[model samples]
Target chain A: MSVLEVNHVSKSFGSNTILQDINLAFEENKIYGLLGRNGAGKSTLLNIMTNRIFPDAGDVKLDSENINDNDTKLGLMYLMSEVNLYSNGTTLKQIISDTELMYGDFDHSFAARLIDEFGIDINQKFGKLSTGYNSIFKLILALCVPVKFVLLDEPVLGLDANHRELFYSELIQSYSDNPRTFIISTHLIEEVANIISDVIVLDQGRIMLDQPVEDVLAKTHSVVGPAKDVERYTKGLNVIGHDTMGTIKANYVYGDLDDRPLPDTVQLSNFDLQKLFIFLTNKYEGSMHSEN
Target chain B: MKTNQVTKYLFKKQIVLLGELYLFAFAIIFLLPLLLSVISGTLSDYSFVGLLKGAHIAALFGIFMIAISTLSYENFKFLIQNGISRKTFFEAQLTVYGILILIGNTINLFYDYLIVVPLTHASTFNTFMSLYADFFDNPFVSVTFNFIFSALLLVFGALAGMTVGSFMTLFSKLTQRIILIATPVVGVVTMAYVANATNNAHYQMSWVVNFAKFIIGENGNDVLNPFPMMGFLLVLSAIMIVIIRYLFAKKQLKKA
Candidate 1:
């Protein structure tokens, strides 16, 4: 029954506004994908939510209480980001112990299993961990801690294909067992496309899209046909972006499609999340120029 | 529950980890006399017990410096990330440092006074046991004053450590460098001022000595009352704890 709410939150670094009046609520027992390009303020927003950094204005609350300095509420949430906040000399085992001591409960057996599966040495010093293993180590903590909300910022930063695959499967299994909320912020959209239930797209310090995956995909589609026929068929539709290949063209359009008869050469396909995200982010500032 | 966990966390980090290094240093310092004796084929009359006592006192300052230098904002960030509030962090520090002071004083008393002084039969070492014997004729009062003085030294070292830690956490690298360069100059100037003030009869009272005497329950009139000194230390410690909390709470994660 817990709900994490960010109300009227805004932050600015000198003249550059990072987050502008961001107001969002996360319900319980759901997976939310936080999608944003570089410098889109994804990490900043996550940092603020976890109390790693204070926002310039407004507050983040858990249920009805302010989360800042509230141990009871903060204990219910965790954030795994790129920052190496762990001390230099601490070992992975010590890290787990410290985390368990702080959060009051941790899945030791599960963490051990994941450590073995990933071939991560629990005795190794945290500072000596490689980039990929560091991510894996943090990912393990994110999964094992018995918290209500886990915000993962770039969870698979240096993970390879095999590790990423293993992580996703383990994540799904963990989610199935615990059914807590997870907000994964990553650039690898295609990999997490099917796993995430909700998609929150941020662009230029603003939330461009916040909807269910199905709803977002339903409203966006690609029309593929000869250049002349494709342009003629979708002239009045909302064309966010498009791709061109000599005579053939596919216009990535958003919004409802008209119930008109289609040409034989025309092909209609559902929009992929990555493509939709690209178009949505690029639609503004006239940067969605068709690739020749 | 949260406070206990944080206390345990800090104890493991600060005491257990750093205690090993400190004990190693103490062992080396304590064994210096034996090593010197072995090299010379005969021990000199210089009191080994006195040397050990001196080393223990130096260890107190070392403890404060090491603790403060090692206590960085990284730990603060780590604790907060794990849901430890600033208040809890402050409480944990005070409890840990206070316990450290008590434990340190007990060990000093046990080995330096009980074992070393008796074994060495060093009469000079007995003087510390009756440090203010000339000023206060009562043996009990003198010993109590010595114990309180030792405790105060430990507490003052801890306060300095906290101040240094807060300075390191609050300022940028450039500002820290500037402060580092200026600290010695400031200390020298203050010491010179105190030395110069000692020449004047009207300013004959050394504030440091007076403060120590006041803490040992002896005022200018040689009055014995420990309550005021004890209360002053408690208040001072409380104020330092508040300062530590405020500095940590206002610590910025990243400099812009």
Candidate 2:
């Protein structure tokens, strides 16, 4: 059993704190969704975890060994970010082969199958790849490398609907086949909500929520009815955020609902991961703004 | 072993690059000119090729190192992407460059002594002999001294390339432009001031001359005494290696 831990990590750029006291443990053989809005420090956290960037006041460790510039420890993890790090003249085949050399193991047949399935010409130079294809290639690297942990930052950037669907299915299949830990950071909450086993919501340089998705969804509810009735029904519950449309309203709650007689126009339904995420991040931002 | 693999790959590329460079250079300087002279029935005539044959092998290797080490940005990006520790890649690259420099200068030594001087009939092409033969009669002692001097220069060239590459990639465009413009202006102004002060005797300039001469020996003897120069170069190289290692410790991913 392998575990990657980010222990009390804090990073700041100039006066702006990117990540503040982030402490999380990722056990192997699970999928975690790292959800955040723009500039919520998702990328910064991922960079720090992968040793691509330094943390100001903490360390990331794999199996109890610090991974900062430790080749043996780092070799067990790979981070696929939205950066073109390969040489312009290198072909995709060559890059993949070189990656295999570095990590000592890569699923060549699976990679070959993926290239064919993705309609990618591996002979083409990496620089000439389209934005969508570039994302696809990086996703392939993330999938094929036989590492214990893989962190993907915006894995589906520039990917079209079909490609994103294909990628998600392949990701699920690969996870099932190998059972490595994957922590994905992306804005596409709805698309990855079902596949992700755990959800980590980041907001305002802090972790707003970190829980199993099923556990989170079990307590989350969308109370929809007349605005006054919905408010009355959820008066004591933890209301994260809500939406109002004229006389009607839907208050999103993060905790259990009270056992009260339902109002005539009131209705209760389980909210989705996206809705939960939206309300959670929105509420956190609101609190941050009020504090400032 | 992984470092060895990395060194192998990098050295392979450098070998290919050096081969191509030598092929092109030798063709222009030796082959083409020799052919032209032969065609014109002037095979024995003195020419530019003979003059250029005097270029030191170590210096040329240093030039080659600068070129490849400057392009090391490409390798850095690739290596860092693959999760190679900075220490691993740095050690691998420096080891490769060191070995290549050693082999390159050794080949130069052999080729000049055996082929160039014998064929061109020009002893001036023998750079090591000209530099050290006056002070040291023993070839072994002289060559050892020459090797240290050449190694220092190549290491400096390699370190300079790494610095330039890092500077180009790490800083913002505005900062780079400002530094680029400011550096030469400052250097020129300082040089003019130094020249003026030295000519007018306004500043004690003997320390300046003495400082330059300090590299020669303890007594500032410039006549074939390479012991002080060797000691100075070794210490300078040691300092540079330490500085370079420190700078390379914690580099994050910059924009490609």
Candidate 3:
């Protein structure tokens, strides 16, 4: 059964509709990648699910129970976003203690290890921390909080390459040790591509694609060869996007590859997640541009 | 039990943060004035002791500001992000209000008993709103009256603080801007009216005068006893809670 269900959720700010008819369900013990471009309503949908902001219509449910103003259901989820809800004078240690108070038990030993690995001073005031350290500290709290579901928006915003690698490994370790659902919204598509099992793509305040990572990749195939031969080979299929380099061409297709033999000049390869995401989003943008 | 745990945690955080603010305000409002008085060697007509007592009132107002500032969106969001719902957060704030009122009035009582009554040599200390000094004729009764009366003052300040904070939180940008510009004008106009009424006996600023008289156990040459002002405060507290809850329910946390 789905642990969390977002049904027909819609939100608007003034004249701008932030989310429109968003329907989603998250199963237990899966890493879900929430992929969307800037201003694509990923954060808005996350905020709505967590009840930080009210939706204009529809509702979010956790375990068949409404999440809004329901302490028991809300207690089952935690959201760590870019906004620093904490005040300037609060120390990291104090924040952790406060989190423990609210959420019952916390993984203190793992948190301490993460803190040491990240070289963060627990006594330092929140406002004194640098930008990268801010994200790191929030990530630590997100990982340690004893909630069944954790939603992280732009979780790795300001991390260096080394820190990002360390975070991913630690996340995997934690998930393996204690299986729980994690919905991470981020722009670094390639980094989380392997880590995430399910992928949900949002564009222009609407869900464009939602499927398993392997399934999405399997459906999207790339045909590369001479420009004319590639076109002939992918004549009737759904061509999402294409790139031309001198005499060679690569056309991305999103449909079942037929059993019919192809020309020798044409080559086919499995679609990478990053390439598939770019082509899918760009295809939607291209349609929008044409419509406008 | 969960609600109690969240309330306890929130109360501790607010108290620590407010304790820092109170210390800072004490330095500026109370200590600075005392230092100036000491350096000048009682140059003013009023006794240095009276000046010090007056500074304590100013410090109380300063604490009220601290309380209002602490009830901000940043703090509210912090509480909610930690899995505390808005309902729980509101309940926690109510607890905070009680805490502030209790601690504030207790400190005021301690000051009146330990410092004002024993150390000061003044024959009479005229408390502006409560006539607390008049109660001094009966030492035991005076302490009791002062505690009750000071609690009322602290309640008023606490209510005002929460109201100001909720007003700032719930209003739109345009409404907030208008309020920011209009508050000083309103204060000045009220002060002018109060000053004018002070001189004319016919004007009868009985709301202030009668309130003070009643708290100090007197009715001021009236045929009938005064209506209980404490009842009004209790009712006001209920109204304030409703208004604050409504405002909080409507408030939206904008991203920063």
- Highest DockQ against the true fold, candidate: 2
Residues A104-208 of candidate 2: C-alpha lDDT, one tens digit per residue: 889988898899899999999999999999999999998999899989999999999999999999999899888999999998999999999999999878998
Compared with the true structure, model 3 gives a TM-score of 0.84
Which stretches of candidate 2 lie above 4 Å from their native place? A245-248, A258-265, A285-292, B27-58, B119-128, B163-170, B201-203, B218-223
Q: Choose the strongest candidate by TM-score.
A: 2
Error of 3 at A91 (Å): 2.1
lDDT tens digits by residue: candidate 3, A1-292: 5479999999898999999999999999999999988999999999999888889999999998988777888888889899888878889898888888888889999999999999999999999999899999999999998888989999988899999999999999999998999999987799999999999999889998889998988998889999999988898998999989999999999889888689988888888888888887888899889999
Q: Distance (Å) between predicted and true CA of A134, model 1?
A: 1.7
By TM-score, the better pick of 1 and 2 is 2
True contacts kept of each: 0.64, 0.62, 0.76
lDDT of 1 at B224: 58
In candidate 3 chain A, what residue range of length 10 has the lowest lDDT sum? A67-76
Name the better of 1 and 3 by TM-score.
1
The predictions' CA RMSDs to the true structure, in order, are: 4.4, 3.3, 4.7
Best by lDDT: 2
Clashing pairs in 1: none
